[model samples]
Target chain A: MGEGLRGSIETTGLTMIYRSGKVEVPAIREINLTVGPGEFVAIMGPSGCGKSTLLHLLGGLVRPTRGQVLIDGIDIAKLSDAERTAVRREKVGYIFQRFNLLPNISARANIELAKRIHGNGHANLYKDDHILALLGIKEKIGFRPTELSGGEQQRVAIARAVINQPSILLADEPTGNLDSHNSRLVLTLLQDLNQRLGQTIVMITHDSEAASMANHVIEMRDGRILARTHHFVYEPEFEGLF
Target chain B: MTHSLVAANILSRPTRTLISILAVGTGVILMLIIGGITTGTLNDYLNRTMSVGADFILQPSGSTVFYAFSSAALPIKLADKLRETPGVGAVAPVLAKFSSADFGLVFGIDLATYDQFPGRLEILEGRNSLQGNEVIVDDLYAMSHKVSPGMTVEILGRKFTISAICRRGSVVRVFVPLPTLQQMNGTEDKVTIMFIKAAPGADVESVFRELHRAYPGLALVRTTDPSVLLADTRMPGLKEFRLTVVTVSMLISFMVILLAMYTTIFERTREIGILKSMGASKAFIVGLILRESVIISLLGIAFGVGASLIIRKLITTAFPTLQVDMTFVEVLRGSLLGLLGGTLGALYPAYKAARMDPVQALSYE
Candidate 1:
């Protein structure tokens, strides 16, 4: 996104079936979707609607039972676990609902883990501090995760997710564990990141308030997409938005 | 950053990590000192015997070099015959006796003949004469017993005056007249051993051959080489003792490291899941765990080496005859083995953590 690099993502006939002791449970039905480069999409659904599973498939966390997922025009569903892991490290950055920060390390260390996994050694690059300051978490870098509040921890997780400047970010319930004040704050930060960096973001949420912040809101029910609605929140600074 | 990432997790549980280190250290110390003293004492005795400058030792057949187990009363006439043999320069008869009270061996010898060798007894603090009812004690024995010259002491239930404090490292710490010891033991014409020296500029091999031929029933042992003395088949259980010590020591490190790392992986399941979700490879996770283990092992090895050195010093002070060899090579062998055992013990746990399913691990409460 920084250099208008490719960020196109697509899935065809995505299907998932869970088997437990010979009992078949269909978690996802056939679905086809495409996201243009630099698009900000929010998926809204009820519990057990397979939104999380879809996010996992997009991130190459699990193999799809049927169908293929393509990131930047490369089909990740055809890759092995190790290959998919490599793709995830280089291309997709995931933010979880729980904000999985390593408790034993400082906030900076939690964010730096992403850079280390990206094989950046300990250099931190030229943009790491800039991203932390952009997220308003530069002051809490020295504090351990346990010393930080829930909202602060989630902000650190966000910083970690985008530190590598990945092409795509797949977030599951980014605001599910936060209060209204913190939820709005996190949503505003996500929107700011999307508009300022032209980064592709696919976030899952249950609140309509959170969904309204995205350029496009997708409604899902019973493992299928029910509707696709555009918000049309056009800002002059985001003129080249996809 | 990677170093601190692994170190922070280990430092978080200081008690568990320290216990693991101490357990490994204790194992290494046990292996080095225990195995060292066994061979140390044996080599020390052999070296002292070689220092006597005796070309060969004549003893009863199949007798151990140590006199405690041997009371073979060979005729004192063996010395005159050994002296008459060609290539023999001097022959001194020794009536060896073990004094349980002093934990030392007492040698009864004729001063004129004993002084003919290169390692003649040198009295450090008193007159070197050995007359009726006179005894000579080495420096260590004199210092430990607090007995000086002219102090009458009861040895073998008989009273005798301490006439001299001789230099240490001699074949025996206490010495008296040969006839006096032989008369007291009721063996008037018998001696335990004879120290024979080859004539200067004579062929030692020829002297040994003539001695062996003349004393076929007696044990003629060459004292010039330590390996020859150590190669005696009568030294029972030395190898087995060393092996047992090494096995027990390695087992301690192996079991402690295995249990500690096995428990560590179980406790950090969620952390493993997070690392995996962050796109860390199996090799990366394994490397992290091994790095922490290596640090712990190095610390343990340092502590073990230091403690062994101190313990060796203490042992030598407490018992002068006991030697504890802690050469650099031996210490290196011990530390390396300790590290190897600890590293091997962590392999299974590291593999298990690498193979964990990220989803399952993350969901693990």
Candidate 2:
């Protein structure tokens, strides 16, 4: 496999509806969007705008009523559940808003879990140390989720998510529970990962300030894309500067 | 993940683990106790029934009825003919009576020939042979009746001296000379049974066949055979009662195991879901749960067997003559039975846990 090669994501006529009793509420309606390889995209909208629903649909976490989600030229919607899980394991990295680390395991074990799940043989050989050093959490490897600060825990979560080195990283308000200082730190890490590693990042956030950190921004309202913005890319001069 | 981790996971919840172990332990203990009692009592009954020193029992043809109530009589001449046959060592005629009034048995034996049989009697007091107007009562009966070696006792309105007190077959017995018994009962010519012994290397089957051929009306039986030992023996109702008791105990053990396994699965619903989400196949999840259950069951079985053995030892010590033998094979059999019962009990819960979906499991509060 080629290192630091990003994968593109595309959705066509994606429609999703939530049904409870006799009521049918549309979450995402006939939406079409595309993100190029190595592109950092952000979805921004108000509450109940189906931003998370669209992200879930694109990630194959939820089945769309009628649509196609293509990742790296293959329509993931056509894959079986087991096959979809395999694709997610091999190609997609998910960072949940809640930082869903298994509470019983230590920080290093949490990161090791991802590698083990992907059948990586070298999971135990300095991989935890490397990820922790990259995230500046080398000392917190032995700590469990309860013992870490919000920022440190989210960093551990991010390390766990990216341990497999997936082609696409999906973040659902990764900084929702952090302070501004931690939020900036997490956002800068995401941006740095996308630039240096060329890992495609698709983030969903309600805050415009958070969305401004991305290279592209898409606005959604009532299950539809209200607007899209493409920002100018600024290539940093120094490489390996950390 | 790893075997060590799986073991740690199973043992992490101390309370749940202990409860599961206790469930298995309880079942094993109950099985051990019931099995011990059944084997102990059955053996005791057999020893007692065979206590008449009868190496070979001769009854009527096809007269394998196992209750003492069967009054089937064998011809007295069969004993004389068996003594005349080749390889014949000794023979004795016995007249067995079941008296509801005394709630015991009275055997009319010839003291002259009873000495040839092993474990014939342990005379506790007084003379060995039954003299004129005298009888030998069992030690238990003598103790219960406060009768000593020379005391005169009345039986069925006939007075006789207690010539000796003896113990045989774990029961309260009384022995009178055949002539006196026949004179008192007015059955001088009839004989209820015959006990025979053969010389070393004599084929018992051939002798049995010859005896049957000689006296076609007499049914030759071996004391060791389960069918023959049970024939014309009292306590069929007691055997049936013991069987019912054992069956009910097993059913209770099964139910206990089922309930415990079901609760264990129910409590681990979220953990199962997590494993499934971690790419664990349904079979893997099921295997893990089953491993956990079997571990708990085996632990319980071990504890139960130990406890039952202790109890059995205590009982045996408390009553020296009451034999309690629990072989290793019996314990192994009991443990395997427990394992099978535990696995059967856990099948439904294992299936339920395996069928759980990851998304739904993670969503559970």
Candidate 3:
């Protein structure tokens, strides 16, 4: 897609280490990865494998202890905290495993809040009705997150994420809290969004079925990439995958 | 949408919101009511004193604005000496006594000498005679106590028949003959103060200066100006008392808002994380929290101002002799102080919320 050219992401030797007192623990270490514009990439890994930390770094949610995170050719790791926040506001949208909808406000308010954070400078490519209808949450936007089912809440969260038409979408197990049927619904919706909007998508998931929807899948272990594949495969070497 | 979020946050926990609002409102009320009473009593006393059209007042050295606080140290013979001074036309000797039962001062004055001033007591009912054991009550005092002409009232522990009801704007609500109050007080030749009036076409400033020169050992006060009369130096402990009341009132608002907003931010830790994850800046987060507090403060101010008005009405209705003034300026000052306290209280919590880590916050249970 021609729009994908502006959403490319690349990282060089990215690292994140969390410290408590004098004890330093590396969450992610020496990670080199790249995704072309509009690429739907899924990261598959076991728990504590730094999949979420990598996603957080990509979204500018945390400052990396070392290395470079390039979004649209601009390195965010070197930017100041405020500057990084501006970049995140203008170019990235995040979806959490729990949906992360502000529970006190209506779904519509949640979506509107993102637009407010993005500001009024950008010329939006899609209207609210088109996005809401595409995500099939136009009728559910009046309810608070607690009142909606898990799948409905995820749909609302997707609408909130894309309402500003950001260039990058980062999902930390977007369907982790959904049932099997809702999981398929959310995955198909993410696939549709990536394809229709030409937005680069980076998602972390344990379910292989969720990974199959992405154009590229990267498997991670101990904060390092163990395999990169174009299609989902239950390989023999990756046994005992609990 | 931001406003709705703030409103929803405040409305979600109705009980806590109500308690916070009430606390802030109570602070404003305390400020307005106590402050109103202090100012009202002071102004009322000073204004009534000035109403007598006296150019100057002579009292014992180091006397306060409250004449009741001063003993009868100025001799009644000082009236003749003051009257003989240059530019002094009339000198009225007044013996003032504090009446605990009335919560005011009782004044003893000679009817003939007091009438020489411009603000003479004009009789509205009964006879214009104040003699032995006969009291003259102002219209306000009469109405408040349901007393009228021919009614016997116990004043200063002595029975007195109401000889007349004067107009409301008098120097004191209760008045007795100068000789009678002096005899009862056991200070037959002593007086509390002397109200001196300048002759017609006489310069008041010259009279004031002459009085000051003539009574070098006594305190000479100009009675024409209210501000000069109510100066802090003349009213000992008045400024400090007002400041103490204001400080206590503001502390209530500050503490309530600090605890409320502090608890609120902790409860909304996850929501703050969500905002940060949505790319909200520190300023945006702080703005959200401040906006909520300002709204709460505004609501509390409105509640406070309304309640203060009602309380003022109740106080005056119950105690007609007492005055509590809640002027527009006082109301505005109270509102602004309450707002300031609340805004200050929210600062720490807002800072904490703004500095929250999105990663840790998102993962928080």
| Superposition error at B286 for model 1 (Å) | 1.0
User: Which is superior by lDDT, 1 or 3?
Assistant: 3
Question: All candidates: CA RMSD in angstroms?
Answer: 4.7, 6.6, 2.4
DockQ of 1: 0.57
- Chain A vs native chain A, TM-score per candidate: 0.92, 0.90, 0.93
Q: What ranking of all candidate models by DockQ puts the best one first?
A: 3, 1, 2
Off by over 4 Å in 1: A1-6, A13-26, A29-31, A73-78, A122-124, A221-242, B58-77, B93-112, B126-135, B150-163, B176-193, B212-221, B232-236
Q: Each model's TM-score, in the order given?
A: 0.87, 0.74, 0.95
The fnat score for candidate 2 comes to: 0.04
Q: How many backbone clashes does candidate 1 have?
A: 0
User: What DockQ does predicted model 2 obtain?
Assistant: 0.22
Best by DockQ: 3
Please list the C-alpha lDDT of all candidates, in the order they appear: 0.85, 0.72, 0.90
lDDT of 1 by residue, A57-130 (tens): 88887888999898887789999888988988888878889998899999988888878988975564568878
As for model 3, its CA RMSD to the true structure in angstroms is 2.4
- Model 2, position A164: C-alpha lDDT score: 75
Worst 10 residues of 1 chain B by lDDT: B64-73
Most lDDT-accurate candidate: 3
Docking class of 3: medium
